[model samples]
Target: MGAVRETLDAVRLVDHHCHGTVAADLGRDAFESLLTEGEAWPGISPFDSPAGVAVRRHCAPLLDLPRHTPAEEYLARRSELGRREVQRRFLRAAGTDVFCVDTGYAPDPLTTPREIAEAAGGTSYEVVRLEGVAESVQTAGVEPDAYADTFRTAALEAVRRPGVVAVKSVAAYRTGFDLDPARPSEVEVTEAARRWFARGGRLDDPVLVRHLLWTAVDLGLPLQLHTGFGDSDIRLHRADPARLTDWLHLTAGTIPVLLLHCWPYQRQAAYLAAVFERVYLDVGLTLHHVGPARAGGVLAEALEITPFRKLLYSSDAYGVAEFFHLGALAFRQGLAELLQGRVDADELSLPDALRIARWTGRDNALRVYRLEADGPEDD
Candidate 1:
């Protein structure tokens, strides 16, 4: 195969699945510095749903509750200042127009039934939503089966607000992943899954996966599922892409499934993508954990194996803004470098780049969330 050279627009790129909420918590200055340092950083954002917001509110306290007094539990809590700060930083660094938010996992905050995301004219921050695979059951104490109803209602209510674009779902963890092998099992493994299942989870049952997929179709939403190695508590093999066969079989003909971070099983995930019409994949954990040195190879593999249109970008950006922004930049540039100079690089040609850039980012999101055409405009 001949090497293919592709040019790119000045905009850099879009990161489909970043947790800007955590980055936003890092404060504005740190966020700005990180973006300024990383030239390739395209966009930064998060799900920022009610569960996300609650996570923002309670993370510190949750961590400190054990050491601190119960009464002072609320004192360690911080704010979502990082969300606004990330916006400010993105505007300053990339000038990109959108930052897709993950709203499916969160219920509508009590203060507002749905606060549609809005972008300021010429401002870098525009809140976009990816609905589905909500955390309502885990966060709001709702039943597992009711996830569909709660998610559909919340999505309808939120999408009506404009900036809402798509629905994103997750099935990777009841607890968090332990990336560092040194500190393992600090988090209870099956217990978290049990907690999640107690509310409304059925990871072992193929029927549950089908039910979730049907719920996506019923709501006419695109689903983004977490598939790859995750926190220590999660069974690594359970996160395999093969287990999603039932889901793939059910939705292959209709609803779009944006597979999020099929890391250890990247090849398997890409194979699945090739076979499924509606199956697309994004690079989240790969970018965050793989780093720039290896990201190029990973991107090349994804581009070579999956159709360009089926490929998407994401930061899976987490922690503080600076760290997240750097991770995002590493991914965008890594992809460009891997696909730009090679003649056989059909995967990263300028056209494919644009498709992955513009269409894959929010357009795919729109199609998945059923927010296309008649959905509300930006808030």
Candidate 2:
């Protein structure tokens, strides 16, 4: 316990994937609403769940309250401090030095990457969502025949933007990973664009989705794929990272493919990370939702077959700063407990345990995301 605490406490985390905190102060209902991926119930409260409980247990102390503070009291204290102060406290407490922010999820007002970096006293980079950029191109009215080139140019331009370090895709939510693994032909993409444009709605066209994904692959940047469990939009069976095996084989060695928030399929995700050189996995949103105690078990499963270098840390936390703090806390506590147990049992030496801890907490992400020597700026 002593060794584990010392090693983990000294490590600064690179939150490889997460979203910005909401810009405005939240009411109790508003705050609780962000706690779960599911729809809010008419009478039931979000605080009845594991993540809510974890927040009370862990994040309460950061807010200057006792551990296990009641949700009512917690929200009141948060409201009194105002949003900026709350963000400042949680982000700083997380011990995260860098944030790789995905700025595409919700329409809710949120702090920009620059703002989050300011709040956390860290540096931040952007992950351009492939789907979001494609939708924007579509909305801007591209001719069906020109959609492919237009999208290609737009995506390339986006990746070249200052601070844009990677790309992301929500294909798991849109068309799933069961699509044809081969890149679509220009004719096929044009036809798909025609169909999508004719339908006149959000880009759910399966063919176009495939086109978007393949384009991301060609961009040669780390691509974060939303896999496993998520909000109601995800089809559980289709969201499995293993479904992308065919695609993985096709895109192998091309770019880093990160599977995010893999919960039930974490073992499967671990298997992929084990077999595929470019594959990596992170149990971010899942960690805080499962709470600190159970987070060890989840991290253990993810680590079982995964190469130590293939696993990265992320919060997948959106709309709230409590998640940033809780995600880091859960990962630190869980990884420490697991590695420390191995050291105690003589399965791993102290030096090896400390090395593994540092690799998972910081070095792995730094190398994967190419953040080496790109340290955060002083606030």
Candidate 3:
């Protein structure tokens, strides 16, 4: 236990994928709403969920309260501290040195990348969401035949922007992983865009989604694909990362493909990471929701067959600073316990356990994302 504590406590995490904290103080209802990914039940509160309970136990202390503070009292205390101080407490407590932020989801009312860096006292970089860029082009009214060229230009420009470290896709939410391995033809993309434009709705066209993905691939930046358990938008069965085998084979050495939030299919994700040199996985959003007690089990399963270097840390935290703290807390506790157990049992040496801890917690992300060793220092 002493050795485990030493290794994990010394780790300064790199949150490879996450989102910004809410810019304002949240009321009880608002705070509870961020606790679960599921839609709210009319009669029940979100605070009754696993994530909410975990927050009361783990996060209450960071807010200067005793562990297991009552939710009502917790909320009252949070309100009293106000948003900025609360953000400061939780983000600093997480002890992350760098944040690679996905700035696409629910963009409004959240801290910008610069703001997140300022609040968290860490370096920050941007992950350009392919779908958001596509939607912006569509909303800007690109001509049908010009859509492909227009999108290409937009994607290239996005990746070239300062502080942009990677590109991401919510393809699991838009279309499942069962996409054709080949890039869509120019004609196919134009027609898909035309029809989507004619329908005048969100960009759910599979062809356009495919085009967007391949475009990101062509740019040669690490590409993040959301997989497994997500919001109501995800079809659990269809979100399996295994379905991506065909596409993974197609894009084999082009760029690193990161599978995010893999829960129910973590073993499958592990298999992919083992077989493909360019594939990697993270159990981020899943960890904080499961809380510290169960986080070790999930982390154990994810690491069971995964190459140590192919695993990375992430909070997947959005709209709330507690998630940032909770995700990091769960990861450190869970991983330390598992690795130390192996050392105690003589399955791994103390030195090897400490080295593996640093690889997963920070070094792996830096290598995959091409980030500097120290990242952009906080100004």
Give all candidate RMSDs, comma-separated: 12.6, 1.5, 1.4
Tens-digit lDDT track for model 1 on 284-372? 76664555556677776766678656777665544333333434545656665665655254534555555555554446544444443
lDDT of 1 at 140: 58
Which portions of model 3 miss their true places by more than 4 Å?
377-379
lDDT of 3 at 13: 90
Off by over 4 Å in 2: 373-379
lDDT of 2 by residue, 281-325 (tens): 999899999999899999999999899888899998799999999
lDDT for each residue of candidate 3 in 202-289, tens digit (9 for 90 to 100): 7788898889888988999999999999989888888999999988888899999999999989999999999998999999999999
- What TM-score, computed on C-alpha atoms, does each candidate reach? 0.59, 0.97, 0.97
User: Model 2, 8: alpha-carbon shift in Å?
Assistant: 1.1
How does each model score on lDDT? 0.47, 0.90, 0.90
How far out, in Å, is residue 48 in model 3? 1.5
**lDDT value, candidate 2, whole model:** 0.90
